[model samples]
Target: MSDPIYEQVRGNPKFAQLVKRRGRLALLLSAIVLVSYYAFMMVVAFAPQILAVPLTEGGSLTVGAPIGAAIIIISWLLTGVYSHFANGPFEQLNNGIVRETLK
Candidate 1:
């Protein structure tokens, strides 16, 4: 017998449809992530507020600005999140499904 998830994926119309939709959506999300990284550069370049802060002992470089280091941290988080899919289980699942479909 096949793996239950695979079996369900093969047999259930809703499951199949969900996979089809989500599979394509994953690709789109991945692409969006790739584009977002580049866009962040533009955003950083345009906004001088990202790293503008009082040069004090206790002040960070991103304080007292509209663009906080928190957003940069979030950008890194988003990059890491996207990279997880780029080089993680979702990629494996996508490859496996494609290989299975091709067979």
Candidate 2:
């Protein structure tokens, strides 16, 4: 037999809201990452010279290096944002839903 608690949680409006919000956030972040990565790849394909340029006059470093680094840093920051929301608001809402459903 299915647990009633699970059924209650499934029926809760807060649970639905949590799922929607969490999913939207995930999708939005994923889209941001995908677009950034793809755009970088497109540039690499069509405009390699731009990325190949030296960061400074006669410098050894290329423009692409810093751009690639920025992409990595942005991804990490996005992950942290998701973690913060998931741990804070999402967890709180989830706990509230469980508590309300149990009572």
Candidate 3:
């Protein structure tokens, strides 16, 4: 049997807005991750020397170490950013829309 509540929410403008906004954000984050990951891979494959260079004249750490760490950190930070926005305003909007739809 078809559900009226589902139908109502499906037809609601807020539902559409929520879907579009969340989809755009997801796509943006995914693109960023894919680009960064592939760029790193390309550099590793085509320019290993670049990542092998020393960070400083006397330092033991290779440039790749820090850059790799930064990539990991950035990924974590991006996830946190998405989580924050999703749990905050996005969740609130979702709840409001669902409540309105039920009413």
Candidate 4:
């Protein structure tokens, strides 16, 4: 059986706004991650010597290590950013939609 509450929520303008905002945020974050990763890979492929440079005069660690770590850290931070908005604003909007639909 079709549910009226579901239909109501689906018909709401706020639901559309929520979907659009969430999708845009997700796409923006995904693009950032993809660009960073692909740029890193491109550099690694075309300019290996750049990453091969040592941090110190006689250090074993290469510049790529920190850059790789930063990419990972940035991805994690982006996830946190998405989670923050999803839980904060998105959740609030969702709850409001559900509450209004139920009423």
Q: For residue 45, what is the lDDT in candidate 3?
A: 100
What would the TM-score be for candidate 1 when compared with the true structure?
0.39
Per-prediction TM-score, please?
Answer: 0.39, 0.94, 0.93, 0.94
* Model 4: CA > 4 A from native: none
Task: Write down the lDDT of every candidate, Cα atoms only.
Answer: 0.60, 0.96, 0.89, 0.97
lDDT of 2: 0.96
Q: Look at candidate 3 and give me any clashing residue pairs.
A: none
Please identify model 1 stretches exceeding 4 Å from their true place: 1-62
Off by over 4 Å in 3: none
lDDT of 2 by residue, 1-103 (tens): 9999899999999999999999999999999999999999999999999999998999999999999999999999999999999999999999999789878
Sequence-dependent TM-score of model 4: 0.94
How many collisions per candidate?
0, 0, 0, 0
